[model samples]
Target: MKSIVTADGYHVPVLLRESVDGMNITPESVCIDVTFGGGGHSREILSRLGNNGHLYGFDQDMDAIDNLPEDAKFTFVRSNFRYLKNFMRYYDEDSADAILADLGVSSHHFDDSNRGFSFRFEESLLDMRMNSKHSKTAAKILNEYQEERLADVLYLYGEIKQSRRIAASIVNRRKTKSFKTVSDLLEVLEPFTGKAKEKKILAQAFQALRIEVNEEMEALKEMLTQALDILKPKGRLVVITYHSLEDRLVKNFFKTGNFEGKADKDFYGNLNTPFKLVNNKVIIPSEEELVINPRSRSAKLRIAEKL
Candidate 1:
């Protein structure tokens, strides 16, 4: 397949060969790339598909539609993968041969400073909506949410130990001025930043806000549930998650075929699961790829097949 990475600097696919190859796609296979950020994986899937095969790429971000490859077999769905079943049914696909989802924010989000996915832009708006059309913004959550609720967002999503302290600081500061820009939030995070692990702490704070703004965990659960329904027997399901929260969900789902991670039991006490883990261990980016793309350092790829 031709390189999808263009001069304009779109996303550079992480774990490219590992992710695409994990799908086990054949010439006649019908596949789906649930988060077609830069069309890298979608393009690779298209290359393996024959004239009779079809590939669907789904993304709620309208900007991603522009990156869609102009191929007859490729169909770009401008919607979240949570609607996977609905779109698959609309297209009359009873089941897909393979399904792939690269979870969390894309490199494009961080690269484009205007998007507010990174802390690099102090004056930028706290608008971290994956789909710009969404109503909620990160600023709103920080300003309007109750202190306890804000603490939960930070503790649960960011996994910060001092979530309560952070939330208290945000609420107290926002009383004087509603947070409108990154600098406004950073000012409150002063005590947390400027330390040896300042970047990590700030990133966590931003991550919690971004995840809440986008409802990412909720969306991932919805999409994963629908994926099982759409995948054919023995079909491959590959997921690349960036954070431990999302990774835990994928790991539990792949193990027990549900989010709770409770293995189902049959009459004979044999475990019954819809999918089996292809890679028993998590796959991380190679040191070489890490050198080339530092953003991929946190990536963890997990592959499973429907039984």
Candidate 2:
């Protein structure tokens, strides 16, 4: 399959069928594709739908809107999935039969070295905004964040062991000259943690900045809660997460309302479970798929049914 370019000018198609398989849609089902990156998954879902079915998609990046299918069954919601409930109100749809989210960076984003997603792209501007229209950029977070706040982002989001040290180095270096490009920042942090087995220390640092610039976690949390609420009873919720943090959040919330909790029971023994997990275990891409698309290596697919 040739890569499809998203309206945002990047190309990527990750976990196409695997992500939508859990949806379990019917001809009349109304599905929501929350992370409409390249519309690859949207195309699959649309094909699965009958003439009466509807597919609503959300994407914060305006460019993603270009990929929207101009059909009665499909609609492009050009907003963050965080505000899914609000958008649903506009569509007069309170609940959906299936909701799918593929949490990841699109090929369009990474291939464009200037997006600052890849560590290999050194001279490109340190701009990692998924939606270039947004005012905040990764450079602002690195150069302007307080050392403590910066450390928190790196530690919590990136899980960087030496978050404090890295943040301190960034702050110190910025005093004389501000960091403007990947090369500028990567060079300074390399000494602290030089090339090793992976030699992708630059990726770790870049991930931290990208996560902060997008506020990925916060938006994810909001989208999850909203999507669950808008799910019809017995509605299928399928999510494909790229990293452990996201997988943990999805897994924990599906198993227990909170990430960490046992099934609580009252004196009458009513189990407190918002949704039931259809797949007791997480699903990963098959080896064949991995060989074809290495990016799917980190992908984890989980499905749950609304109670």
Quick one: best TM-score, which candidate?
1
lDDT of 2 at 25: 83
Residue 125 lDDT (model 1): 91
- Location of the lowest summed lDDT over 10 successive residues in candidate 2: 1-10
* RMSD to native, candidate 1: 2.5
- For each of the candidates, give the backbone clash count: 0, 4
lDDT (CA) for every model shown?
Answer: 0.88, 0.82
Residue-wise C-alpha lDDT for candidate 2, range 130-172, written one tens digit per residue: 7788878888888899999999988887788888998899899
Q: List, residue by residue over 126-215, the lDDT tens digit for candidate 1.
A: 999989988899988988999999999999999999999989999989878999999998899889767898998999999999989989
- In candidate 1, position 259 carries an lDDT of 92
Per-candidate TM-score against the hidden true structure: 0.96, 0.93
Model 1 off-target regions past 4 Å?
1-6
State the lDDT at 182 in candidate 1.
Answer: 92
Q: After best superposition, candidate 1 residue 17: deviation in angstroms?
A: 1.0
Q: What would you estimate as the lDDT of candidate 2?
A: 0.82
